[model samples]
Target: MTDHTPHTNHDSNRPAPDQPRASRRGVMKAIGAGAAAATLGIAGISPAAATPDVSLPTDEFVETDGTEFVIDGEPVYFNGANNFWITDDDANAATEERVDAVFDLFDELGINLVRIWAHGEAKEGELVLQPEPGVYNEAALEHHDYVIEAARERGMKLIVALVDNWDHEGGMLQYAEWADAESRYEFYTMDETREMYRNHVETILTRENSYSGLEWRDDPTIAMWELANEPRLEQDDVPNDMDDLEPPEHQEILGEWIQEMSAYIKDLDDNHLVSTGSEGHYYGHWEDDYPDDDWDGQDYLEHHSYDTIDAASFHLYPDHWGDNPADPDDRLSLHDGADYITERVEDAHNELGIPAYLGEFNVNLYDHDLETRNEFLEEWYDAADAVDCNAVIPWQVVLEDTQDHDGFQLYASDSGSIIEDYAEVVAEKSGDWDGDNGNGDEETIAVGEYNTTDTTSDGLHNDFTGDGETTHDDVTAFFENLEDDGVQDNPEAFDFAENDELGFTDVVELLRQV
Candidate 1:
């Protein structure tokens, strides 16, 4: 229960459900009034029929329960997208419309979670969240407020990161300049800069949402707060005009900062969860590509162990991180990306016993064709699921109108299909992720108001590829096979829609399980 020095060795890590799932038309009832009952020791899950007893977080926010994320006693497996420009504060009349459009697209795609930046520091001449220390821009704040309210209206949960490591919209560099720190690294260490940073955090935590009439700190729609995006220790980030600090010491310093900042945010807002938004670089895991290198300050296990932190987040850009040649372009292979994801997720979800999220990932289409990128994405998605990691949020899924940045932009038109497919995969297992917390405990009884659906079937799997596991390839194969005689004659076997017919909806449910 303690976040500080939390001991995470679960009784045994819950292995990903291996049994193929059988889907019925709808969820069975009486989940709370289980034919039997058991508990996860939290306060809220009730055994009563109306209450549907299951473990709940101490509060009604998206919370970490070991490797699962639960809300109102239901496990949430989200297919998410990120858009850093949502709060750009463009000062245009269309900003609110832009926010609505983005949320509308997310809803259309079944995306339940989104990651957006909360920090937009002042630049030479630009709109920003904080124009000066202890000062904020209402226009900028309005744009952000609208995003929160719009997401609330659309039933979306958000992960709002406090700052950025990059200087895209004046990140740590701007903070360093604001406080006149000797270096950007001082943003993490200098007392004055630290206070400024905390002041910004407080400003956000205490602000009243102009649109929602709800305090930012109390909104359940805001699922989690990230300390920063892709934060790195001075040692690893030395290339970015930072002076090299000593080894391990830099890690310790950043670790202390994460400890302090996470606790600080938790104190200001206990209604939501907190995470270290690190790219969770793993050293000494795989000898070849993942050699013993301190590429990022994120020692995954150590940083995520902070008691108040609820989730462990990492990003994947194999095109950027791969050292050896796995593909024709000498990039990291699909297997390399898979191993990287598995190690980090297992460490956080299994070893640290927190939900592991791939907060940003993309296979570059600039380097390869979209087909190649799609193929790699499937391998990575299965890798995360292979370790029971719930969410894999791609970097920068933007509206077709938004400008694509960093060659990682995923426009709704091109990559939106991937998001829809991922959502369907998790949706197919709707109630299965609930109390099956990998504790190896057969809930003594199923006597709750919920958690009553049975998804696993003997042989009726959507594993269309026959790869022995369901994955994105199956999604493709199911579509490709629609013209085959077997599929034409027996559409019922592929009826994911449960309408006794086969269609695109059925294909969306494939490649979900591997």
Candidate 2:
């Protein structure tokens, strides 16, 4: 949060555009109609096209190997900024100017990704995406459309998160209220609330971008879809009998949601990658065993291990977690913070076999000296490099100067320059990679070669009932248990064809493995 303003991601804590050459931003446009350019252009971001037909390259879409982010067969190392306010409900020329300048600066700085919120429901204002259950405000959507179209124009990829864990901007609590559920937790449990969530997801994904004339589901500029921003709940968030649902273990509640939601996203769009958008709290490999880690009820290892989650998303907030930037002796020391980066990044790759993303990390200018802040960031960056982390984005970078004084805001003209410098250094040598994304050169593996190491109930163990090996017996078991709750919950694990669905074809592919 900006000095506890808006929504800042991670810390298990609380939680645009533009008028220049704005796109028509009409709804229901085809996904391929992005040729419609902005009427006016920003200096750094995509400006208005000189011609009516601006053909974009089809190969530009980011391809993932589940270990790295790749575009056009080459692996990519992303160093980008996060700006959530570009799509703020109250849009004016200044807001558009800010968006233009930030994107312009990021493009000039060689940063490649922008993670922003696709979810927000303001309680007091008319500017909200989903004001009520299944209802959307298109006027508010025009702002969001500008953000996407502007990025697309600039050749920038985005990691768009769907919701927030806290109630910074009318998060899950608003959904619960709309559904008449008592607790915000009902947003995940109640049938009515769950459907409402799904409706929002579909609306966001399928809605046509007014400027780009492209449906969001088909937009290649979007690199990934996050289920939520730092999704987790405090232990006090118990299930209300009003939903008439049994309760899961504190952590399992979120774990279940992550698994289902990620899988659901995968079911809808195979073109883009999806993640939990959690702060990558650990379930398996935990070092400090800090009690605060448990406060959010998130299990990083378990959450990322789900079949459809393409990468591990986590954040770094040393100051909030326990680090007192003034007192170098704080428990979440700089060194410890660096170690946090290495541990999560390495664990995600070595254990779960997916790329680990440091979704948000920052040094609050209000809390530390410029020297201390730079050193803190350098330490974490080095750790990320050493462990081969796929992507490391700071808390946020903006163009406005007044916001620079906030707890985590980093304006491009000021503290954000620090990241600009860092991104420059990482651009040339950075090379954390992705898995094979059907390059057509991969060798055919034997039936038993579908390897997996998810030992717990949270993972996708190849071994049906026992050892981590697939066999005819396991296929038979799969057939028998097709209707079982566990199989129904995680059919992707058995989907040998690698299609994003679980159906008769998946069962046939399972049989072929035998």
In model 1, which range of ten residues has the least summed lDDT? 1-10
Residue-by-residue lDDT tens digits, candidate 1, 216-246: 8988878889999888765644335655776
lDDT of every model, 2 decimals: 0.64, 0.64
Query: Candidate 2 has what TM-score?
Result: 0.69
Can you give the TM-score per candidate against the true fold? 0.69, 0.69
- Report the backbone clash tally of model 2: 15
Candidate 1, superposed: residue stretches over 4 Å from native: 1-60, 92-94, 124-126, 236-243, 283-292, 323-331, 431-514
Model 1: how far residue 93 lies from native, Å: 9.7
